[model samples]
Each structure stands twice: as C-alpha cells, then as structure tokens.
Target: MSVNALISNYFTTGALSDLPSDHFIDGVFVPSERGNRMESFDPGTATVFGDFAAGTAADVDHAVSSASAGFALWRDTPPARRCAILMEAARLMRAEADWLAVVESLDSGKTLTEAYGDIHGSARLFEYYAGAADKLDGRSVNLGNDNAAFTLREPVGVTAHIVPWNYPTSTLVRGIAPALAGGCSAVVKPAETTPYTALMIAELLIRAGVPAGVVNVVTGTGQEAGAPLVQDPRVRHVTFTGSVATGVGVMQAVAPNVTGLTLELGGKSPLVAFADADAEAVAEGALWAIFSNAGQICSAGSRLVIHRDLHAPVLELLVKKAKALTLGHGLRNTDMGAVNSERHLAAITAHVEHARSRGVEILCGGQATSDPETGKGWFFEPTILDGLSAQDPAIQQEIFGPVLGVQVFEDEEEALALANGTEFALAAGVYTKDIATALRMARRIDAGQVTVNDYWAGGIELPFGGNRKSGFGREKGLEGIDAYTRAKAITLAV
Candidate 1:
C-alpha cells in the first residue's frame, strides 16, 4: 500500500491490527513468560494505541541463552555468507520502508518525513555494515626468522542493545547492524515506549535468512528488561543510547560483569554563528538543529552562541521562522510534530517555566500547546529564551525539548567559552564564511562532532559519539564495528 493510504487507514480507524505486540525470541514472536504486557501510547493523540509483552528477568534469560547458542553458530559462518545475509536484510528493509516509516512515526511521534529518513538511514546502516562484514582483516607482523605473528579480529559473542525512544529505528539499527555483521548475536531491549519497530526489524532480518536465535528482542521497562540483559555475564558487549542518568545505570549494571560497553548519552550542544555567517542560513540551521524530532535529540543544538553583531538578526529570523512552523500529527507531515509523551511534555513545560521564573526573556514561544485540530496531543511551542546566562539551568542542563537559549559573544574566544560551558560535549555546529575561523572552532570545540557551515552536516559514514559526560566509544563509520569485536594475537613457530 502507498504511504498516504496507510496513514489514512490509521486515522480513520485509529487501529493497526497487524502491529506486532509480542516479544521476539529465537526468531519467533512469543508471549512474556509472566503473561505481562505494557501499553504503548500514540504521542500525537495522547492515547494508548497498542500493547506489547512486558518481558521479565526470565524472558531476558531465555533470550540470552538463545543468543549464546546462536552466537556460536554465527561466529563460525563464513564472512562472505554473513555479508550476503545482511545485504539481503538491507534490501528487505528498503522494500518495506514506507510501512516501517509509518510505524515509526506513530510510535515515536516524529513527522512522517523524519520517520521516512530514519527508516532509510536504518537500511543504509545495514548496507554499510554488510560491506564491512568480510573486511574485518587482521594484521601480520614479522617477529624474526622462523617465527610469525599476527592479529585476528573476532566477534565478541552475544551482545545486548539497549535502545532509546527518540530516533527509534535508526538508533536501534545503528548498534545492532554492525554487531550482527561482525558475527555477534544480539538480544535487543528496545525502550518500552517504542518497541514495535525493533521487533519488526528483527522479523525482517529473519525473513532475509538470519538464523533463528541470532536476533531476538524483548520489550519492557528499563528496570525489568534492560537491567537483567546488561547484567548477564554471558553477554559480552552492550551498546546503549539514552540520557546520562540511564547510561550511568547501565554502566553500573555492566560493571560487575566487566563486559564491553558503548554509550551515546545526552547533550546540551551549541550552534556558534560568527558575524560573517549568513544570518538567514544560520537561522534555518538553528530551526533544524533543535526543533527536529520535537527537540528530543540528544545532540540537539539547544544553545545559540552568536557573535554580538549577528545575534539580534539571527534571533529575529529564528523567532520568525519558529513561529511559522506548523505542529500536528506525525502522519500529517507538519513542520513539527508532538512531543513523545505527556510526561515529556510536562518536563518541557517545567523547563520553560523555570527559565521564565529566572527572568529569561521569552523571545517567541514558551507555552505548552496541543494539536490544533484535535487538541489532544502533547505539544510544546518552539521556544526561544533570550537573556540566558552560563549559570542558568536551561543553559547548563539538557532540556530535551524545542527550547533554544540565546547567548551573545564579542569574539571567537567568547563564542568557544559559551559553546563549551555546558557539561555536555556531544555535538556542535560552527557557521562562518572564513575557513580559518571554521577550522579553528572545529578543532577547539570539545564536542565529538563539529559541523562547519551546517548544523547536521555528516552522514552515517562519520563517526558519532561524545566526550566528557556525553558518554564514550563511537557509532557509525568504521569505528562502529570496533565495539562489537575484539583483537587476538596469534604466533606461529616453524
């Protein structure tokens, strides 16, 4: 069916009967061992659309045991065969992109356009890692005569992926694809709020020739499903993407086991615009940087650090453009969509209210709103806070909403200070006409990824992760697979 047709069907009936609502274990859909279930809400409508299995510690144990066995079989599979299976999975994902996109939009409350991009990006991740499956080459060294030394890259056995709600499809795929490609079996614990897409993707992998038990998914709350999976000693690696608090918890859970870990955490990233930058372009970039996904992104450019000369003009343009943005259901393809949940909506409201109380100027929008037609969804206005100081909580902490805090700087040094003032160092953007200035800012910024002339510049080929409190390790690019594999030194005597 066409994308429009699918969307129309959803709004007409408010039900998607075929949506998977069971845990996927050993390559098949199964009920929770405890017969427990959890409801998933449609954030756009603030209504419960579906329910899925709420996995328990027993379920996690079952999935892990299945994965352990699967890992042994997959590890011995030829790399060429592994590449072929992953490539087929990518093809299947593309073939089903429209359906997956609609599901993602409904599940995550992102606009259909963004959901579509995420689905395609997920496919691209599979494709990228498929090509790398057979290329995990080791190195050879000459120790001396009659002796040879080399290194072997091998899979790290069973892996557990703890996925987040924001950017559900892409984030889940970002971690699992490389691990699967590297011959490791995965037991995914998708965020309880967004579990369908992960289960759907696992089904697609099975259809594309992945063996039973190689890819399993358990759905439930973090405490129930995620903790046990991470704490399991049999699981060799864990990749997590979420808030700093949760990442820390995952670290604590995995510490006893001393398992391999990769964390992509929260951010309060800045967008630094020099005086020479095009104000109009910088304004547009700012809109996309923070407002996309309803500003639920971890690496969102939530802080605007602009040169004093460009600050007024840039803020003016940003406020004007932000006001013009349309908010609605994800299926409607509006300029912006609802926040993920009512709880998140309340959090955003609290952030804005606290800022207002502290005398931060509300340059444009700073109120909680709802969908214009139904007036039911959890919506927040695209807000801009003007008189923010480095000490303000809004400037120092991650609001995780469509709220931008404006700060002015007199020179490059001041701009850098404002950009790096926050505890986060995930991502940043520099807008300037001068190459030297752009290069210098990129070098000096503490962020993991620094985009020049644009806010979200690079593709999946770029390594993405953070420094400091934003968490460690990396995802995407060639480095993405490194976390899932380990190196072993081999010596030969003749």
Candidate 2:
C-alpha cells in the first residue's frame, strides 16, 4: 500500500475504525469508570489514531469479580472443549493475519514483515497449546500396599498478563493461550502504546464461543490499570514482559499476594562470532537480529563479541548491510520503521552519544532521523559502537534499540568471559562451523538459551525464558501451561 493511502485509511477507516473504544469485560465491551483516558498515536507519523477507556482500581475489582465467577464453570469444562475453542481461535487468527499485521505495524512502529511474523507466531503458540491441553499428565506414585496415590493438575483461578508494546500481538498470546488451555480465566493488560491488537484478539476469542469473563482486556497506562490489576489479591498469577526496573516493581507489587510470576525482562544479549564462522552470514543475521523491529526487542543481540581474526571482515559486512536498509513508514514496505515513541528514541540516541563522548568509534550511524515522507516520527539510525571498555554503559545496559557494540576477543576463554560479563542472562548466540567449539560456547555462555549457528532459533515447542535479573519462570511449550496450574495429590486406601 502507498504511504498516503495507508495514512488515510488508518486515520479514517481501518483496524482503528473497527475496534471498540472501551474495556472488554464479562463478554461485553464497556466504558471505563475512570475519565482519565489516553489516546494511542501512530509511531510513524505521531498522529492520534485511536482512544480507549483508562482502567482504574474499581474497574480491576469488577473484572476480577467477573473472572472469579467464570472460573467455576470454565474449570469444570472438559479439557477437550478448551482445546477445541483454542483451535478455532488459531484458525481465526490466520484468517485475519493480514489485517492484524497491518494493525501491529502501525501501532508499534515495526516493519510490516516483522508484524506478520509476530501475528503468525501468535497463531502457532495457540495451536501448540491447544494440542498440549489434553496431554498434561499427572504421575501415579506407589506408596504403601494399602494406599493408592495419584496427582492431578488444577488451574489457578485467575491470571493477569501484562504485555509489552515491542511485540504486542505475540506477547499477549504467549501469556493468554496457556492460561486458557489450563482452564484459567485471564485479565490481559496490553501496553498503552499498542492495545489495538489485544482488543481485536479479545473479540475474536469471544466470537469463538469463549465463556463470559473467561477472557478480558483492560487498556490503560501502568500507573492506572496495570498496578491495580497486578496488586489485586484475587489475581492468582501474573506474567509480565518489559524493562528490568519495571519488572522489579511488578514483583514487589505481587509479593503480598504471593502470585505466580513469569517475567521476560529486557536483556543485553551477546552474539559471538568465531574465526571459523561465515562472516557474511553472521553479519546478515546480526543485522536482522538487532534491527528487525528497529531494535526494540527484549532479547536483541545488542552486544557483539567477535574473534580478532574475524573482527574487521564481519564489522565491514555489518556496516554495509546497515547502510543498505531502507527506512520509512511500516506500511510502505520499508526495511525499518519508527522507534515506538519519542521518549524511546531519545534514550537510544543518548546511548550512542554517550559512547561517542567517551572516545568510542561509531563505524556506521549514530543519530536521529526524520524523513520528509513521514514527518514528526521517532526514528534513529542503525548504530555500531566499537573500542569500548566492557564496563561502558553501551555494553552493560539494555539499549533496546538498533545499537550494536563490538568487542574483540583473542581466544575462546576471552570470548566466553566477555559474553558472561554482563548482568543479564536472557539469551546468547554463537556462530562457528566447529561443533566442539559451538557446544563448548553454548554450555558456558551463562544464558537461559544459546543458539548454535543462528540467533533466535527456538520455536514455540522450546521453553523460552531468562535467568538472574532477566526474570524467571518459563513460557511456551508444556512448561507454559504448567505455570498456570498447580499439582494436587489424592490417595485412596483399601
């Protein structure tokens, strides 16, 4: 679609036109009790695109009450029925993939291609969970001769999902699908920056015959809706994805309630390239790894640790690819889009400038950009910073932008040390042709997930999570459904 046509359609009649400007609760869309509502803006144009009700404490009370009421019936329903409903939801997601992709692209400032991948991944997650819903087994334990013991998995009554704006569609599904599969009612709070896709999915789940209060969506800022929802005593479990600081705050809020938590906090993930690796392939993967969503990813490969022999060749290839990337509005089929928000843009720009001030070499780009076609948007150049100490903020912090820091290591031990030097242990990747070297690095990387030859290689079947400050608990695969349930032991004596 043309840029002008996309702007006109989205501003007047598109996904925003079809969305309900209210919270979804008890099988219906209703206005929020709080009057302090905020409008969502297009990251590409900074245009006010849509508005929704701002939720409050009272709203959280009402939603939790509704979910509690629905829990009784939902938990009693057979697991096969739950699986069927989720399967239908997955079908609907594929049917509406195109529209949802466009909606995600405009709402979150990611390229259209990346948005499509997120929507597709959302469907895959639901489908995988649907198949596993009925497969959760409880083991039988042999006790005394007179007694028979067995265990059963039971759903935690209500769950709250606080998803981030980076990949709103996939992140929202990543939390809600497993809860539904485990027969638990959920109240989802999508990031204020990108709530449209969540609202759309809520409606789709309802249309697939989800029971009243089985799924609900509350839209508002963290201060208003998120805090009250997480702090609610009735909410049994909480899954959040965002910055580490905000994640700590969430943990504190849920501590009183002792709610179950699964957090995917941001990380300064490292990508290590060895002398035996393919320079061109690693460079391409590294570029896509860090810049695909304009570098707004929780596990982005922001830190690059390269072997000295391959450093110059890989750096050159990366710079060439970065310069070749085209930037514009997401709907215009560009390689990159806006930076989600002006505040985020400023933070990313500051990191680059900080590196420059400290006498670091910027191999490629290191500034903000405003194209004439998309005026007044938050955009930054794909940046590469070299010759920096390991303790530098650019190397240790989570920039969460299209900024990559390069470090040269003399040997394998030095490479492993550099990769494990950071406080984060969410994810890491190693590129090498030698199997022994790849396996050794993978085991010693000190990350929850280590991809051998590719970055972000795992799928929905594999458990994805982080360690240390990156947060805990697992999402995706069977572990995801297990997180929403608790085990109960039953014994019978003859």
Candidate 3:
C-alpha cells in the first residue's frame, strides 16, 4: 500500500488487503535506507506474507533522533490531552480489530482467536492507560516550617523498545501504550520477522491524532538495530520482551547510560495438579497450558506436576486429549494450529529429541506433521514426557513449544521445590480445592503470577512480571503504566 492509500484507509478501516514495504519513522511510513529486505512467512502455508525494509543502525539512530526531538513537545502535552489521544487510539484499534487480526495472523502465525484477542487485549491496554494518563498525580509531603513538597511522574524521554516476534503486536503495545499515556515519545524496534503489524499499528496511532515523531518503528536484526537502540544514550529508558540471553545482552548494552530498564523475559512456568483438584478441569487446563498459540507464551505451563496417586488416570486423559487435537491453519475454528516459524519448529523438535535421549518417556505424539492443506505448515504434535525428574533438561529449560514435561511429586514440599527448581520464575499454577494449600503455594511459589485452582495468566489489567532469573519489572496494570514514568521530587519554601 502506498502512503496515500494507507492514510486514506486509516479512516475508512478497510481490510488489510494491501501491505506497504516500509518502516515507520516520524509518524510517516517510509522505505528503509538499507535496501535489504526481510520476508515474513505465514506459518499456515509457508508462504511469504510480506517483505519489509530490513532496518540498519543508522535507521535506529534516525528514529531515535526523531522521537527525542518530538519528546520536547510531547512530554509536556498535558496529561488530559494525552489521554484523549490514547483513548482515541484505543477506539481506532477497536474499529480496525478485524483488520488487525488478519494482519497479525498473516505476519505472526497467530490463531484467529488469539490474533483477534490480542488486538482486543491491546486496545484494552490503551483504554486502561488512557484513563490512568491524567491520574498520574504526585502526592504532597509534609515538611517543617512553611514548606511545600511533592513528587511528579514524568516521562523518561526517548524510550527505546525492542519487542519479540512471538507477541510483537501486543508487546509493542505494552510499551507504546504507557509511553503514549505517560506523555512520552518512543522509538520502537519491532521483531524483524513480524514487522507488518507494527507498521499497521503506527498507522492507527497517527490516525488517533498522535503528532509526528511521537512514536516510530524501525525493524531489523537484533544484533544491529535492536542493540544500537538499547545502547543509545538518548534512550532514557529501554523496554524489552524476549529471551533471557537477549535480555542479558541488552542489559550489558544499556549499562553505560544508567538507563531505566523493563524486561518481560522467558519462563518455564509450572502447572501443579493436586489430587484434590477436579480431574476434568485439570486435564483441560493442562491442554490449554501448552497448546495455546502452540505454546509460544513465555508464561506457558510447560511443566505439569501431578500427585502420584492420581498420576496414571490424569496422564491417560491428558494423552488422549493431546492426540485428539486437530492441527491446521490458525484461521479456521480448529483445536490446534501450526508453529510460528521454521526456527521455532526446529527448536521444539530438538528439545523433544534431547528429552528422548535423556531417557524420557513420550506419552503421546512427539513429532511434526506436514499436511499439504495446512501448506507444508509446521505443526507439531502436543507432546507429553514422563520418566522425567525435576532436574531433567527439558524441565529445567523453556522449550517454548508444545512439549509438556510431567513430574510426579509425593508431597507439597516436593511440588514447591520442583516448581522452583528451574531458573525461570515467570508463572506457575496450583490446582487445589483446599484454600489453605492454594494460599500456601501462592505465597511460597517463586513465580510472578500464581493462580488457585485455575490457569489465569497474561491480562492487560493484571500486573505481569517475574522473580529471580526470569528478569525484572512489570508489564500490564498500573505498575506497567508507572514503569514508563520516572518519579521526581519537588520542594518549595517561603
């Protein structure tokens, strides 16, 4: 789509029938300086969804400069007015919800339900932060003599965000939502593979009355554009959501500037099913645990620990459910879908192979299926592995696929220990009817989000983050809104 048409459709809310091969800079869609391009493949058909200008370091600098320049005015744009703009953006997002889903499914192998839900979820974030925009008030502090003191929540100028490909559209929204709400300007470097949705989102932001340079997106390889953006001194804050390794590297890259950091990184979240829990509900939750988005979520329930007394029956039901899923494209109303990319499929397969070598027992389907109707798509069987201890390699690492490693425990002490065995502390669940047990585990579990007799995680209105090695800082909820702001104190005396 040409710039003219894109802007025209920005108001018309047409289908995502046209994709412009460009990066967004200074609120305008433009071609990349580096003529090199990257092609996004549709996981459903292994077809080219679109090609985008592969951004370079210079492009990152250009975006950062524009955002920084824009910040001088945007940061001071009264909170009430900023809220109006973001609220408009949220409304615009809802208006184009169908188009957003289509673009997301094409660019990211997202299921219809997930792609559409992501758009809705993202819109909620905008709406939520929009309301909180003007609510960012500083409280007064009492002091001796005739003195007045208080604090102000100010925007950390020129923030740079590096969002992951798995949930690019939403993750970028996670950062951009609060930045815009907090009256800050941002330069976003979206994942190279899934740049289309980001471009489309930038268009919505512009239509919502966001001024030029308030938000810009540059896409490229992480080693170049992502790293440079993080390292840039002008970026007062850096927000990233990806792997632990990448987050560590980004931390080191941004260390020189004392930049504010918010990282929503990887996870090996545990799902524990106690004997007292409802068997049917537990089995169904386990299915949702590792199969949603083909288990692309960082907080996915990849590890399932069941009580030994009920393990056999639960395992039988789980295996049966796992094998019965229908694998196809994300567009249809199917039980399952293709993996996101060739690289992700390869990694999932490698993890399964590694588990098999480590004397793990495969309880069900553990291989990939290439159905032509799905277009040589990368669909993997939802796998369950028994004969694995908490210390098993599969249990200790984040496979980020549909591979669930089951570990049996005799007591609550063992369950908690096993759940916390991995370095990741992103998310975990305890399924138990006993309120005491649920409360105990909720307090003891080394995870950011803990649920009782349920599989609740990832919501725009909830605070999501991790403890220990799972990375730091919160995204979503009020903390997420505050994460984009820097609190400053001011004092006055007569």
Candidate 4:
C-alpha cells in the first residue's frame, strides 16, 4: 500500500470503531460504557488510527469482576478445551497475519519486515503455548511407605498485563498466551501510542471462542487504567513488559496486593567480538543485533566490547554498513525504518546529544528528517558512538533507538566487566573461537541469556528474561507458565 493510501485508510480503521456498541465481557462482544473516551495514534506517521471508549476504573472493575466470576468455571474448564480455544486463536492469528503486520507497522515505526516478523512471532508464541496448554501437569511423590505426596500447578486467576510500544503486538501475545493457557483471564493495557493491535487481538480472540471477559483491553493512561488494572484486588497477577522505571512503578502499585509479577523490562545488553571471530559476519550481526527493528528491543545489543586487535577493522565495517542502511517509510522496502514514536525519537536524540556534550565521539547519526518524494515520517541514521568511558552515559544507558555505543576492550575480562556494568542483565553476546574462553565468559557474564558466535538471540521458546534492573521472572518458554502460576504441595499422613 502507498503512503497516501495507508494514511487515507488509517482513519477508517475499525478495530475499535464499534467499541461503544460492542463491549468485550463474559464471552460476548457488547456495548462498551457510553463514551468517546480515547484515541489511538500511528506513531510512525503521527496520525490518529482510531478511537475507543476509554475504559474507566469502573470498566476495569467490571472486567476483573467478570473474570473472577468466571475463574472457577474457566480453571476447572478441561485443559483440552483451553487448548482448543488457544489453538483456534493461533489459527485466527495466522489468518490475520497480514492485517496485524500492517497494523503493527503503522502503529510502531518499524519496517514492514520487522512488523511481519513480530506478527509471525506472535502467532508462533500462541501456537507454542497451545501445544503446551494441556501439558500443565502435576507429579505424585512417594513419601516412604506411610505417606503420599503430590504437587499441582494452579492458575493465579485474573492477570493484569501492560505492554510497551516497542514490540506491541508481539509482547501482548507473549504475555497473553501463557496467561490464557494457564486458565487465567487477562486484562491488557497496551502502550498508549499503539493500542490498535491489542484491539485486533481482542477481536480475534472473541471470534476464536475466547470467553469475552477472558481477554479485555482498556486503552487509557497508565495512571488511569493501568494502575487500577494492577491494583484491583480481583487481579491476582501482573505481567508487564516495558521500561525499568515504568515496570517498577506498576510493581509498586501491585505491591500492597502482592500480585504475582512477571516483569519483562529493559536492557543495555552487550556484544563482545573477540579477535579470532569472523570480522564481516560479526560486523553485520553486531549491527543487526543492536539496530534490528531500529534498536527498540529490550535486549538490544546497545553496547559493543570489541577486542583491541579487531576493534579498528570491525568498527570501520560496522560504520560503513550502518551508514549504508536506508531508512524511510516502514511499508516500503528499507534496511532500517523510522523511530516508532516521537517520544522515542526524542529519547534517542537526547541520549545522543548528552553523549556528544560530554565529549563522547558522535560516530554517526543524531538527526531526523523526511523524504519529499515520500510522505513525511520520522527517520534516524543508524548511529554509533565511540571515544567514551564505560561509565559514559551513552554506553551505560539505553537509548532505545538505532544507536550503538562502541567501547574497545583490552581482553576478555574487561569485555565481560564492561558488558556487566549496566544495571540491565538481559542479554549479552560473545564472539570468540576459543571454547574455553566462551565457557568461561558464559559463567562470568551477568546476564540471564548469552549468545555466542551469533546474533539470532531472541524468541518465544528460549526462556528470554533478565536480572537486576532488567526486571524479574521469565517469559516465552515453559518457564513463562511457571512464572504465571504457583506450585501447590499436597501430603498425606505417613
């Protein structure tokens, strides 16, 4: 679709067009509370996608109350039935892949390639969880002759989910799949900049035999809808995927309630290229690792710790490759795309500016502009920074854009130290030929997951998560189910 066409059609998007007439509650799509409450935007183009009646505190209360009312029925709902619904949801996701991809690309400033990958990944997550839905099991234990014991995993009831704008479609499903598979109902609050995809899911899940109240979305401010969603005593769990600060704030809201939490937060993950590695592949993978999806990933390899010997060559190649990346409208074929939101653009620009003011080298890109031939949109050069200490704010902090900070390391230990310096322990990469060193670095790196000799480092089944300030609990794997549930032990007299 052409830029003009997409813009023209944006206003006609009806994901939430009938919200006032169709409320999602208790397995039915009925009228939402009477109001023209909130609007959604296409962050890439700065256009209003559509509006929905913003769900109020009362609305949240209604959803949770409805979910709570359905818990016993849903939890006792045979696991096979739960699996079937999720399986159907996956089918619907596959059917709507194109639409969701377009919606994601429109809402987030990601290339169509990135957006397609996100929607595909979301479908895969739901499918994976569907395959595992009926696999939730308990174990019987023998307590020496006289006593018997067993353990069962039970759903934590209604869950509150909040997503960040970076990977809106994918993250929502990433949280939603496991919650549904565990027999828990979810009330999701998508990032304000990109809520349409959530509405898209609500639409599909409703069509896929999901009980309406089982998956409700309320679009509003975090303080308004988000806080209550988490604080509602009826909500037994809170799963948030966003920045460290926002994740912390949400946790604080649920603290008094002690809601179960699986907070997937941010990272300043590192990529270490030792001297023995393939220069070209590492350079390309390094660029892709960090700048993929314009470096908006929570596990973006934003820090580079290259060996002293290979630093110059690798740096030169990376600079050339990053500069060669074409940025423009996400719909058109481009190696890179625009910043997802203006706020994100500002955050990226601010980080780069602060780094430059403090004397860190501005290796490339810290500006935004438009292509006249095409419609106006946000674009940034894939940026790199050097000549800064490890503590330099540019290298230490997350810019959350297509910005990479280069810091050379004398040897393995220094590389590991520089990588571990950030409060985020989400992901790290080690490029080396020495198995001994790789194993040693693996033990030393302070991250939950480390990629060696490659940059294909994220997904649904890989137990993706972080430590320290990167937030806690795991997602995208069997552990995600564990994260969403509590283990119950039963014992008998010996």
Give each model a TM-score. Answer: 0.99, 0.97, 0.95, 0.93
**Of the candidates shown, which would achieve the greatest lDDT relative to the real structure?**
1
The TM-score of predicted model 2 comes to 0.97
- Sorted on TM-score, highest at the top, how do the candidates line up? 1, 2, 3, 4
Task: Count steric clashes of candidate 1.
Answer: 0
Model 3, runs deviating above 4 Å: 1-16, 372-375
The residue-by-residue lDDT of candidate 3 on 1-494, one tens digit each, is: 44345434532442345675687999888777868788777777676756778888889888988998889989888889888988899899888887777677657766777887889889888999999999998889888768899998888788888888788788989888988888888888888778888888887888998889989988878887888899999999899898998899989988999998988888999899888988888888898888888888999999998889768878888898998887776665367667878888999999999877877899997897764463477888888998587778898888998889899999999988988899999999989999999999989999989876668654677889998778899988888877678789999976
Pairing residues by index, what is the TM-score of model 3? Answer: 0.95
- lDDT of candidate 1 over 1-494, digit per residue (tens): 89888988989888776899999999999999999999999999999989999999999999999999999899999999999999999999999999999999999999999998998889999999999999999999988688889999999999999999998899999999999889999999998889999999999999998899999999999989999999999999999999999999989989999999999999999999999999999999999999999999999999989888998888888999999999999999999998998888999999999888988899888999988989989889999999688888999989999999889899999899998898899999999999999999999999999999889999999999999999999999999999998999999887
How accurate locally is residue 231 in candidate 3, as Cα lDDT from 0 to 100?
A: 91
Model 2 Cα lDDT, one tens digit per residue, 1-494: 54345556875553455656788899998888866677888888777777888888888788888888888889888889988999999999989888788889889998888888998999999899889788767899999597889999999989999989999999999899999988899999999888889888998998886898988889888998999999999999999999899999999999999999889997889999999999998898899889989899888999889999999899889999999988887877589998998889899988888888888999998999964484667889888998667899899999999999988899999999999988899999999999999999988888888997789788888888899888888898778887899999999987
Q: After superposition, how far is residue 265 of candidate 4 from its true place, in Å?
A: 1.5
C-alpha lDDT (0 to 100) for residue 450 of candidate 3: 89
What's the lDDT for all of these models? 0.93, 0.88, 0.84, 0.79
Q: Residue 322 in candidate 4 has what lDDT? A: 83
Could you tell me how far off, in angstroms, the CA of residue 340 lies in candidate 3 after the best superposition? 1.7
- Per-residue lDDT for 1-494 in model 4, tens only? 54445535653552322223233566654444645456665555556556655666876777787778766667877888888888888888877676777777877878888888888888888888988889888899876787889999888898888888888888899898998899888888877777778877887887887765778777767877788889888888888888888888887888898788888888998888889988997898889988888888988888888888998888889898988888776766477777777667777778877877778776777666553336666666788887568788887677888888888888777888887888889899988898988889988998889888886755678898899999889888888887667789999885
Task: Give the poorly placed runs of model 4, Cα more than 4 Å off.
Answer: 1-23, 28-36
lDDT for residue 155 in candidate 4, whole number 0-100: 89
Candidate 4's displacement at residue 188, Å, is 0.6
